[model samples]
Target: MSKRMNSGASQQFVIIGSGQAGGWAARTLREGGFEGRIVIVGEESHPPYERPPLSKAVLTAQKPAESCYLWSKEKLGELNIDAVQGNRATAIHRDRREVELADGSRVPYDRLLIATGARPRRLNCPGADLPGVHYLRTIEDSERIRGSLSKGGRLLVVGGGWIGLEVAASAVSMGVPVTLVEATDRLCGRSLPESLGRFFMDLHLRHGVDIQLNANLTRLEGNGRVERAVFGNGEAIEIATAVVGIGVVPNTELAADCGLPLENGIVVNESACTADPCIFAAGDVASQPSSWLNGRVRFESWKNAQDHGVLAASAMLGGDALTRDIPWFWSDQYDVNFQLLGVPSVGNQVYQKGDTSSGRFTQYFVQANRLTAVAAVNSPRDLRDAKRSMQNKSQFDTTGLVPVLTL
Candidate 1:
């Protein structure tokens, strides 16, 4: 076993939660020429893996979970970093500069990075404790869901967001009867525009996925296992299984217990540092302040998490000051590819550059006659250009944007 401490008072870097952010931080430390005792503590038994495929390819059994791992065990060994997996960081004693583990061990550190990610929000309705009810978050969760889906049984999907829709699409492709319920008036209401939302609504409906909008699920009725769901609209539907994809709640209990100021997530400055200079945070768990968006936004996207990891690592290494790029996200549902850049808040004037009726187009959100954000469906070329335009905050001729689409 490698000694935890080296000669002299070399810096001890401890990272909690071995997700994207934590993994990146460790890698960055080595790459940045930091010769310190680096240790990563993760609660999961497996190493940090990519999560975007959880609801898509992995759930469909098209790809194995091991393929999603970003770093190999050999790679970590080569980097000379210690990864303590399957151990939870129970508490942090900032005054003593030590992190307490659930196994009754304490690791002293000179600096700490918190990368605890988010968890799927559980359904609070009655009978939510049934056996057949599932939530997608980890590889284990996805494995169980894949088994349930193999039964070729009725699937009741709760929520209309990306995860729910992606799972619904996968289940439908497998010939499983799926009924998706959303509490909102449209699908992806918080992220997508009405036109794009309607386009997806039509696409799903045409593919035999029964979608119920404005549906408030009252309870899940079953005999020790999920059997049916009763809605507030006084309608009941028999279901073999129920999958909840409502949203996520940041795993900030440790930070909150330590009296860290948390608004939606762990509050961090542009450098991804907390109020204390010795501690930092990133990924979905970090509510980083964005200078580009002119507000503090906790974005739930793969790109954001990866970007945050890089930025936080750079900041920790005392590199150039961190800068927030335009937030971006992508989703693959059925045959359509949706990409969004920047924050598309409500009341932004949307300028359509292509055919929305045909469901292949790009919509640019213009505020003050400047392209602030964009959403593209089946239009990757436009998405790339729009991303550049959004970064520059430049104006483009609407007619010209339509012609230059082959990038």
Candidate 2:
């Protein structure tokens, strides 16, 4: 148990995990009139940087790793943030109101925020730890994978999720022969509708990517390094390297050790407040309730991190701000820019306008005739209008909207 101590008014605001959420939280606190001291402790030596570009721009060498930084020393200094890099918060001593660092140092705080992000979910096959096995969760990982691409060998992408598909697209663009494998029956089975999944399949097929669905991996057979992958059906494919982009597991060990309530992630209400009054959580680690869906959901997106940080900071400052914003995520594959608004349900009626084969279309998902969600591919204009209609809770009228949308 931690020592109990009274918190003084002069105590500083401490934030653990200096990713987008932590960076934005520190900045938002200053903007929200927090005049006391602020300290941001980060495990990574590098200052806050964006992770979305790691899979695309960074892997393609189009953007350098430094280009993704979220803040400069001057910017953080201007905001009065004491940036402590290369330090990991080992434990949260709630009773003492202090966070213990890996280096045996402790930082006292009146208010503490945990934004420890997440790590890639790794597989446990025999050759899973081989030299060629790679996962993209950080800039360093991207750099390693990009270097491997330059070596020139057949690449095997395991997982058909967004990250896997994006990496596959980038590999294809580099003129690398790629083989993508997904355990599910279709690509993006967890997110996109069946029709959209087929559309994506067609798009990738046209690009020369050999996609295999409903295929399960038995093990990776290699000598010192990966040379081939064995499937469950006794089929083996010769490959030079492999990249896995299945999903991520939130960094909740510290929170769990502190006895914080967790369901999928650290439990928090819409206001981002944990069970402890002085402690709060945000970003991927916080599972917040959603009034739009009338349930709790955890969002792991760049926008969610930025928005949740601001909202969590406001709540920590004794403000009554709660976020009920619609969740949106986008992916860039080849030449198509795919965007999804709100969460798509299985039973929602899908309506398509424009031609999908031509790489320009807007998909409207209506629940009981009320516009609920929108998906667009290379059609930004329709996406904007569809978003407005969905937010306004307008009923979709095919006859009335045809003239305006050219349906």
Candidate 2 per-residue C-alpha lDDT over 1-407 given as tens digits, one digit per residue, 9 for 90 to 100:
12322222376899998888988888888877778888999988888777888889988999889888887878878887898999889999999999999999999998899999889899777789999899998888999998888888999999988889999999898788999999889988778887788889898999999999998898998888899999989999998889998888999898899999998888987778899988889999888887657788788888899889888888777777664567888999999999988877756767778877789988877778777778889988887887787778877775533221211
* Reference-based lDDT, each prediction: 0.84, 0.85
State the weakest 10-residue window (summed lDDT) of model 1.
Answer: 1-10
Residue-level error in angstroms, candidate 2, position 209: 0.9
TM-score of each: 0.94, 0.94
Q: 67, model 1: CA deviation in Å?
A: 1.2
Runs off by more than 4 Å, candidate 1: 1-9, 400-407
TM for candidate 1 is: 0.94
Q: State model 2's lDDT.
A: 0.85
Deviation from truth (RMSD, Å), model 1: 4.2
Which RMSD values do the candidates have, in order? 4.2, 4.0
Clashing pairs in 1: none
Per-residue lDDT tens digits for candidate 1, residues 1-407, read 11222222388888898877778877887777778788999999988777888888998888999877878889889988898999999999988989999999999987789999899999999999899899998888898998988876799999999999999998887789999999999999888877678888998998899999999899999888899999887899999888999999999988888878999999998888898777889899999778656778788888888888877777776666556678888988888888888877665777777786676888877767677778888999988887777767677556644432210
Q: Whole-model lDDT, candidate 1?
A: 0.84
